[model samples]
Target: MSSVASQVILHPNVSKSLKVLGTNLGRDKLYRAVQYFARFLAWYLVSRGYKVQGARWNALKSHLALARKLMRLGKPIEHLQAALRAAQIAAEPGEQITTICRQLGYFGYLTYDTLVWANAIKFFNFKPSTAEKVSKNANRLWLAGILFSITHGLLKAGRLANDVRKLQNAHLTEKGQDVDRDAKLGNLYNARDATRHQFIIDLLDVWIPASNLGFTNLNDGVLGIFGLITSLMAFRQQWLAVNGK
Candidate 1:
């Protein structure tokens, strides 16, 4: 019994889960998943005439949003630094431009979002209209960031496709050459897969800010599901990175 208990305690999966939960990103993703789930549940319950129960879930969602805001207090600077780094790195001009714009958009969003969080916590006593304006601007910036990300992903996919075609042609024509075609193709495929994964996540997430900005009329139920899906996708990626998988 003691040996069995020890085995369970020392399990690799358990260790990896703990490692994932240790990071701020991991914790945020977990909380975001729950928050979005609560948002969907609240909407469903209210639609079914369970106002009181729905209110409880709505409160849960609000609290989780507040917690996430607090966790991201210093994230604006991180985005700024990322933008700077992206500018220095060499890449196709389109990719480099989109990457920098995306980072800057996020930086703007987070800066405004910080103000929104402060207002929510009563740390800043801005007028209600001012608060609304700030929040709207934040959502706008977030949407821009996601749009830039999507553009970057599309450009990356196109480049990858071109590379694959070129590699295939080279392999066919240069059969006597010592080029490692298979290894190169494998690397390109992996990169393409990662790009596609992020593209999907971005596509799902864009609707959230769009809805907030009134560009879309998605209700809480649909928005909640979208948010939950993107959060889980990000969480899985973070989990794999943490576990060295």
Candidate 2:
């Protein structure tokens, strides 16, 4: 089909019309359409960062790790640009991921000053308002990023698992001995992916809420632990991806 035809078919009104015509349109299709329409709103709030009270980091969390590594290694500005491109390509095409890449790209541009100042403040441990200001900002940003990863990643994995379950159920037949093997294989893959996502989600959900409730502030110590473990996992993933393992 032509691009225009595909767009017309995917349009919300068209989808609704199909549903009205007794088409067995899945709820997932409707949900995806709604998400597409809400992309701009989500992107706007996400770009507002901490300003809007509850905006989380989204995929910018991944970029932040690369940012941290780049800044620490004194990598050139070009390296950051390359990393931003990489991140953009890795993420699915959508306003939310676009905002995340842009936000992290802007931060990457500040490497010369922001990274230097941040490092100096950390090393010196200035106990006055300057230190407090730095600490507070860092803590809040880290908390936002960590929570964002946990929540969104879990939701995505859960949705995948649910879809697989639906497919598996739809394949159930009267002939019990001749089961649909493809559905079984798909469920196996879903189970593996779900387990991985749940593991990370569980790991963060435990300490993150606990740290927040106990102190009402997720500072360096709390977020640091979350970031550290997640980063290690990310590194492992990168290694596997690069090696085609």
Candidate 3:
């Protein structure tokens, strides 16, 4: 009923984190402002009925098993692409072109699972399937490929010259900028561009920025993981956006 209860209800991970944080997620009273925002979000989502009590309990158990498997046995995520594909098929917008009102009344795509799965599927389409855990090497290569794709796109555009003259790409110099580079989707190359990619989510948790230049740390490995994801995503995006194939 309370706002705090709402957040915990909706975001089971936060609910768990609150438990872990020493009855308040181990955060300090000094972070009053941050706590308020956190409380507000929890309450808001709760009020909006975002939490799934049944799913939360089941998911937490599955997630714990997976974590233990990863840590102790070192088992990798298997059939990841297939799982992604299936999940995508389940959650994605139907091929049918139904009315917006019909879509709204269904509340089908509005849930968190649908939202995350949709992007995860998209990422899977663009990124290679992996047998092992996500690694820096893969991270770098994925980042590289992302940059390459974006840059290749840019080189197709025409207006990229005068502005990009300063940002000579490591790969572009060898290949030269194309017409794509000449276009004006400059914000796509921004530092905050990291926000664009699919996140590494586990169970009820979605990775969020923990390292605070501005935002509160939420979720497990919230700050460090998302920061890495964002940084790599941004770097790759910029590299691709600026460079040409």
**Worst lDDT window (10 residues) for model 1?**
170-179
Q: Highest TM-score among the candidates is held by which one?
A: 1
Q: Specify the poorest-scoring 10-residue window by lDDT in model 3.
A: 202-211
Clashes (candidate 2): 0
Candidate 2: what lDDT?
Answer: 0.47
What TM-score would every model get versus the actual structure? 0.94, 0.40, 0.18
Candidates sorted by lDDT, best first = 1, 2, 3
Off by over 4 Å in 1: 1-7, 172-179
Candidate 3, residues 1-245: lDDT per residue as tens digits? 69988876779555544443442212222132232333334444455676564345335434432332223221122223333443444321321111222222222212322323333445333233331223223233333333333333333222334334444452445443644444433643541233223222211112231111123345323333333344444334333443422
Model 2, runs deviating above 4 Å: 1-127, 172-202, 205-231
Tens-place lDDT digits, model 2, residues 91-188: 44442353354344334434433543555546445557765555445444444444444554555566557666766667455675235657575666
Decoy 2 TM-score against native: 0.40
Error of 2 at 227 (Å): 6.2
lDDT winner between candidates 2 and 3: 2
- Alpha-carbon deviation at 120 in model 1, angstroms: 1.0
* Clashing residue pairs for model 1: none
Steric clash pairs (candidate 2): none
